[model samples]
Target: MVKHGEEGLGFEIVKAVLNGDIIEPITFQKVKDYCSTSGIQATETHMRVILSNSTKNSHSPTYKNYFERVGKGEYRILSEHRRQEKYFWLNVDATSYEWSFSDLKVGRSQIYSNTNPNGAKRKKETCFKYIQIGDSVVAYETGTTKAITTICIVENKYELDDEIFIEFKKSVDYDLYLALESLKANGDLKDCDILKNHRGTLFELEKKHFDIIRRMLRTLNASGDNEQDLHEKVKQSLADGSDERRARLAKRDSVTPVSYETIVRVFKRNPDVIAEVLMRANGICEECLKPAPFYRKFDGTPYLEVHHRIRLADGGDDTVANTIALCPNCHREMHYG
Candidate 1:
């Protein structure tokens, strides 16, 4: 058992571990290093004392009690508030811990319509033409009635009753409630266009309501953008095999093989044949039909080496019927394999 004075050192070690400086399965040398840095002048005996105390208190029996073992050790710091669950673990030199754990609450207030039971109600029915569901409204007590809360819609129409109901997706704080009361009493509700100008206020509403309004605005403004339709058309064409079918059936039938030396000789002797072949193949490799075969030698100099279909060693003659141009890989694979 470690003495009470040594418990202070143990506390410092715990602090270091929690601060992400020291880790579990910590070696004596590592603890010594931490003590040196922390100005504790710790010894192997002091480390053993602390380890014994920690192990005695540790809930897990498999956990190593002392540093005599050479292999790595694992230890956990159990939360007093939560006995069954370990909050953090110290592995070697890396300690992992949860930052925070707290419950979050989210709720909204209910919308209510205020109407007088004794007083005669307005004869005209409220005709809300431009009123939207997400529109913000002000609620306040009408006249000198301090207790009765009055809800003000965007407009006070002849058809609308004096009492209006505004739906709130979130519980408003005291500051917002006061502001709404001020706006309602000032006759801002008569100006329906003013609600449209208060978009910045609506955007500051609860995240759920803001997202709903933003999506509604997008749906209202979605027009004249056919780029997505054009993309779908191209995607359908590729998926339907039209692009691949056209590329496969293309005129890859007439390419002929001619060596780099033969090409130079032919260019000198019959420039017309070289030009005709280039025009027919459209300046592409006859084997792969890829444009501009700039083959280079080991010295980095471009040397186009034309291949023959039938090698002279195999009793193959030099005729267009048995000749085909090939890249180096295709040429080597043909000869070797």
Candidate 2:
């Protein structure tokens, strides 16, 4: 029964990842949040138990692997209402990356297959194969002629084993393409380097990029005039903080009398206070009442977050009444938003 429950939780996590709602760079707290918002009635303990056991089950791959598979153009989880075989095209300006039957044909045929013995298939059999300039095919894998591509292509062909290796580009959604293009136009492409490198590490970075693009699409889809302004505001907020402010605030408040130096000393002695405070806050999430469990103190404790109801910079008193317990998600919202 326990195993079954864990499996259910694992499935939920996978579902969240596929939906692009899990928040990138899977963390325990993030997973917890996913569970909460997903309306799954599982506790963090249940989540941890299932996740830990799932990790050991051999059937379940690491969270990193899940994102890599999704990001590396290997697999996708389209909405159920969408047609299965039909491809989605992502258009940016004049260039469009699409997941058509032709693209899949190229990817499927370029590599050796059990049915084809010539080591070289006919051109028409690979109707989607096309050659692009200036890139080398690094690797190729075999699959059915129907697999989808989710990433975009930089070039069309790559050199491999002294042969002209054909490169099949990953397909992108229109919104993602425009987002990348916008970043490139603004010299912010480096912010999306992980997505470029196929590293799947973008999960660790702030979700501001993803959120911006998503919001832009939402606005445009709704024909809202404030889309650009909303995008800029979101971008500015993501750039202003490191993930360490919550910790620093916790340390500052841990002192016997709550002096800066004493807070530092207390934090040095007991780093867990941060997590303690957050736990005490019942994981209710200080901001928006959503589950946000990812937080730490300067000392790297896992609980007890320190929150200032009134901003010190705003001339709010530092008294306990003016302070309240908050989770890391709330702490960040307070600082960033």
Candidate 3:
């Protein structure tokens, strides 16, 4: 029996080289060059399998239905027969496993078929075969955070030593973490496959639902705030009593350290304002009338922070009239309490 691996492999290679315009035909020589550079072994006969003429030479019906020969060694994908781009919800147990998302971000994650028993092995095989280039995947951390952590575009799929591996290119960073509850709350995703079942590691997500999720993530995580505004937002998130505390309590022992990239603003304050406020208050806190927490090691000056009556970002002046010196405890209470 013909392995038909060439047909599958050729189809993916052609798909990757397809231009968005689709008006231009892809030449066999171009495909060959790509295969040569990409380390894909292919013969002229296997290359012909990517065209419609291959149907007469081989029993493989896969690519035969999609590609049509427009000229000698030139092919154009059948516009009407092209497969639609697929969307997937892939569950990654990043909380339980270290460095999973980091590896996934670099397109090095493996889809292990031998990790589980019969049913899981079958599912892994199906997912490996089903996912193709141009597909979009939303990776969800299901072990602990229960949030959609990253969005990825499927770039390549191949088998090595009988094990399947997928290469993914991260399209967008869902750093804010679209929580499971937030997804469940969306009306369009309420009946989504993963939400309804939540059984397997991979599930087909509807394009409409995927679009909604993408839009929601991009909108919620949009940045352009002043440092004070950003700080206030962080405070608000911490003060949110909906489910944060409960979730933290449940994962007290299972908690693992994870790092995320974020853009933060560091305020550049007027030094004269701090010096004048400290001079006016001496070594006492303006708020609590208490002594400074300690003396600075370098200059032996009392350690105190100048508190702004109204934040500078909120139109407060950077002068002694608008600032006051406070000890560490009083400053902490002024900001946190």
Candidate 4:
């Protein structure tokens, strides 16, 4: 019987090179030995081809020089992230994963996953950093079908790779396997290998498949959940959710028109105050300290305008102390500018 591993032979070679700390380029023997111990069945000639083909002519299709050739028949893996096949799903099973990730409650939790294959781990602690915020997670219930479980919200504000927080919504149903079955039955999931029983803590799925899974999850609600309950919850949690709170913040920033009338009391000017202040100007604009620009058409005086030092709208008294004669330019500035 042939032993099997999910990653193919070439990938294992890269893993071996990464596992090594030696300064010298990885030789054929090191990869061959790693493969043999790891249950990788391949011919010595096959290993030669794997090495030679990885560096030669750059196939750009299969195991291309995504690796660096250091010396004759010696190479190092480059673009390790690209070398690993990107998965369409991310596994979130903390119990089996031994608290690899905490369940999100009220919208935040730190996410972490085991770094395997010895190579990728050295590059980064875990595959957890590969997942960005807003990326969907397929959380399996602890000690169960290794299936979908609950909805956990990733906070918009998270410390990169270290302090990720997720909040679990109140919709407490965990029968995501049924939803999975529905997806498979409707030609949704079975065609995709990402939905299968993949080992390791973070099973990845494609964006499209993840979107479908999220849509399926949306249709499910917790026991005794209702629209009224959800409405109140959303209202209450608005201050609590970063996503919704950000939306509200944006809404607040956006221009909004409000209509109302204020009943501010008007102070009857003493008329004497206006006369005295205007006289004090003496054919000059008191504010601009320049002679009046033009004579008033009606009064034929220096045309300096009588104005309030402080606007009545601001609760300033209608007294000479609060008045300043100004030219039309300065008057307009006082009123509008």
RMSD of each: 31.5, 25.8, 15.8, 21.6
For residues 16-58, what per-residue lDDT tens digits would candidate 3 score against the true structure? 4442211224566666665666566767777755653432424
Model 1 alpha-carbon drift over 4 Å, by segment:
1-7, 18-20, 41-44, 52-231, 234-337
Counted clashes in each candidate structure: 6, 19, 0, 20
Clashing pairs in 3: none
Ranking by lDDT: 3, 4, 2, 1
lDDT of 1: 0.34
lDDT per residue as tens, model 2, 245-293: 3445456743333322210111121223333344445556554565545
lDDT (tens digit, per residue) of candidate 4 on 1-337 = 1242356666656554433311124567766666667777878876676566353546333335445666566765565433333333445555544542223333435444334334244222244434333344556443443446554433221222333222222223332232344555546666677555555555446756766676666554333334335334433543354454445444553222221211111233333444556567878888779999887564365766667676553455555567798898998666445
Query: What's model 1's TM-score?
Result: 0.21
Residue 226 accuracy (lDDT) in model 3: 43
Worst 10 residues of 4 by lDDT: 256-265
For residue 19, give model 1's deviation from the true position in Å: 4.4
Given candidate 2, what's the lDDT at residue 207? 45
TM-score of 2: 0.21
Of 2 and 3, the candidate ahead on TM-score is 3
For candidate 4, the lDDT comes to 0.49
- Model 2 weakest lDDT span, ten residues long: 260-269
- Runs of candidate 2 exceeding 4 Å displacement: 1-7, 23-25, 53-86, 94-337
The TM-score values for the models, in the order shown, are 0.21, 0.21, 0.45, 0.30
